[model samples]
Target chain A: MRQSSSTTDEKEIRETVAIILQNFSPLKENLIPILQSVQSAVGYIPQPAMKQVASFLAVPAGEVFGVATFYNQFRLIPPGKHPVKVCLGTACHVKGGNIILEEWKRRLGIDEGGVTQDREFSLDRVACVGCCALAPVVLVEEEVFGTMSPSAVEGILLRIRIEKERRSGCGGNEE
Target chain B: MKTITLTIDEKTVEATEGEMLLWVALDNDIYIPNLCALKARPLPDANCRLCWVDIEGRSAPVTACNEPVYNGMVVKTGTERVVRLQQTALELILSTHPVDCGRCGKNKRCELQKIARHLRTKLKQKRLRDISKRLPIDSSHSLFSYDPNKCVLCGRCIWVCKEEQKVGTLHFAYRGFAMVVTAFGGAPLGEADCTMCGRCVEVCPVGSLIFKNAEK
Candidate 1:
């Protein structure tokens, strides 16, 4: 049953890739846009999609992978439901950004650029988010929490846990 | 191509109008410290910022690899500002690189070491704290070994693999501090579709990529 389901997923991915590839000519210049469309459709650039792209463009798979990794915008893994990004820009670094990052890593039990075992959260460190005014900032999904401290990191994660529990109708007090 | 003359370091030199300043300077026996440039490849990667030169009119130093030569252009290859920028770039590259030059295969022949010495930059890595990921070495390929810790990410190997040789065996993976050059799909180099071409190793400026049988 698992093997059959995985085959179905592969078929789905191939269909998605075919639909996206039809719009653009298979030129070398179209690689970036093709990758962008695939990422947008699938939420991340899976290894299978990269292989499909390499064959479609008649380039080596290594070349495609290299180009993708050179840019900071590409993501290899599927992001968690609530993606966490900590700023490590020059301004943020000066404002104890590393301390806040350490707190997040400790609480999440994941290092930089890792997803939690439960897949509920993923942590990443960005060079900058263009909001330098809010130094030592952490972005959970689209909401930016500024002037973050180590204790505040705990508060944010706890809040997220409670919110998830509430939505699922399972409060902390429940056995 | 029409030949044009430009003033570099107060010395007049003749070069083709469309020739890159870096190559023209090198052809005339004028040294410009660079890492990602190759005489065979006309296109410049411009990833390494070590070849900055002060153009008379430009506000900031321009990479010699990307700057095209023009008639009557006055260029300063080494100035206080240029040297400082080169030093800063070298320091940043050194920060993530392992400082075990004594044991490295490239040791005395490393371009990074030569540039550091040329600029009088200290090799202590004190400016920026070291944040090395300490990635595992890949000695899977019978022809060569790839050590990420020694890599400077100059893009020379990638260019050689993709453009010159068209083998495309090596590619960049991840980004920012986690960035690394790896085989496709993160496969072992020996298991990939590698033809065992030594071009990547030949073009590498550091000991990150080296032939397995090379004399140690």
Candidate 2:
């Protein structure tokens, strides 16, 4: 069942890429927007999609990857169901943002720019979210937890897991 | 092309009207400490803010590589303000770069070393905290080796690989502090579509990329 589902996901990604490519002329200038659209359409920039974009635009795959990686807006990995981001801007960094990030990595068992084993969470450190007033901020999905501490990371993860379990009809417990 | 006359350091120089100010000054024997500006490839990435020059009627110093030459423009290349900015920029670049100069292959010929000597900035890199990427050396390529620890993030190699060589084998990966130049999918440089052109090695300002045969 898992193998079949993954294959279906791959098919869907290809179809989505084909649809996105049709909208733009095969020009170098369109590479950025194409990447942005692909990311918007499918959460993140997948490796296969980058290859397709490169071939479609007649550029090398490495060049496409280079442009994608140069910009902070792009993400190569498939983000998990709940994306976790820690702000490391000047304000946050001064307020112990690194400690908070370390705590999250410890709990998730993943380094920066990594996805959890269960595919439930992905962690990243952003330069800034323009919320300097809320230093040491952590964003789980769309919700922002401001003035966060290392200890707060666990509570946030637990709440997210419990909510996910309840929504999946598992009653927040697994035997 | 129309020829324009500009005064750089009180010396009049003639250049094409639309030529980059940095090249105009350089062609006329004027020196501007720059790393990313390449003469072969004219596109200036302007990431290195070292080529700042004081232009009359301009409030602040501007990067000469990005600014176009105009007739009767009075420019000062070595003003105190310009030198200070260049020194600061060089210091910032050195903070992240490894200071193992004696052990580096490009010891005497390194452009960064030349610029540092020209500016007379301290070689110890104590102004800012040192931040090293600590990436493992990539010696997989039969012809050359790629060392990210020594890279200054100058986009010259990327420009040569993409524009001049048209190979596009090397590219900038990640962003900001975690940024690096790597092959597609972080594959070994030898395994990538690289043609062993050596243009990247030639354009590299530091010892980040070097020929295997020259490795000491």
Candidate 3:
């Protein structure tokens, strides 16, 4: 069982890297764009993407993987369904956004960049969204909601839950 | 075989195959302001919202970056509404960013500084002091230091780090106010597995990431 699992993991990793290389061939000029696309497609750039990117570009896999793992931007794991980003940009921080973020941490029971236990939410902090007028803003799934609070977050969560239940119930009903 | 004519600032201009409405305006010397766009970079980010233009047929302002040129795409380059939107976007960016221009190395050279000077914004806008989170400046290499406090998070650094150098050492960490670009384990830039290629510092629009030599 252990051998099978290990092989499957390796296979999956290879496949992911293969997909990255296939989509972006001739690895030098398009190296960065290819990596960006891979990360966009799969939350973070996986090891497979690095290996394939390295081999396709004719660079060492270790070199490619080392670069991938070096930067702060690439993520290894699949990002959650909803990427809840809190604005920690300097302006937001000055305006008590940190306190609001703390409230979110307490409510969500996860630190920054942490996925919820159920994996429904992934919380991240952004440098700045450039929306300083809407200081203390939180972007949920790419939609910006300004002047956020813990209570407001709860309301947002409730809406998400209700939407999920509705989706599940409708699916069950159809079944 | 399709030709679309457009009017910019009341002057008639012609458009050819696959031209964006923005290119037409720029070609005609009608400058509609934008922040995230450089003629050098591929296209508009649409995140800055500085180049919102009012097209005749479009109900809402279409970003000049993404909007393709259609036949008779009448674009108003200098309208009060467009100016207001640009000002608002600028103000928002300013509110979160520090106003310590005197001390910043990019004092005269920053694109943001240029915009502020052009807009004649007094720097009187209420800035959020607490929003200025101090990120560990990666001084590992003798070449540069990345101060997260001044970063605008335009994703340009990310673009340069991964895209140009292919050294993925910098990334956006945490979400919201806690968000910053850092190496693994939040290590300083020097300690992180960085090649110190200086590409990320080169492309950053603001003073957040700077080359040590370039520091004023």
**C-alpha TM-score for every candidate:** 0.75, 0.79, 0.53
User: How does the DockQ of candidate 2 come out?
Assistant: 0.62
Ranked candidates (DockQ, high to low): 2, 1, 3
Per-prediction DockQ comes to 0.49, 0.62, 0.05
Candidate number that wins on lDDT, 1 or 2: 2
Better lDDT candidate (2, 3): 2
lDDT of 1: 0.87
DockQ of 1: 0.49
- In model 3, what lDDT does residue A131 have? 93
What docking grade does candidate 1 earn?
medium
What local lDDT score does residue A91 receive in model 3, on the 0 to 100 scale? 85
Tell me the docking grade of candidate 2: medium
True contacts kept of 2: 0.85
Report clash pairs, candidate 2: none
When summed lDDT is taken over every stretch of 10 residues in candidate 1 chain A, the lowest stretch is A166-175
- Per-residue alpha-carbon lDDT of model 2 for B1-216, expressed as tens digits? 998899999999999998999999988888889999998767688998999999999999999999999899999988999999999999999988989889999898898888888888876778799998899999999988999988998889889998998888888887788889898999988888887889999889989999988878
lDDT of 3 by residue, B29-96 (tens): 87766655544456556677777788887777777866777765678866777777777777777766
Per residue, candidate 3 scores C-alpha lDDT tens digits across A1-175 of 9899868866776676677667665847777777787787667776656666766887545445545655556676666777888898998998878887888788789988788887778888888998999988898888898988767888888887787888884654221
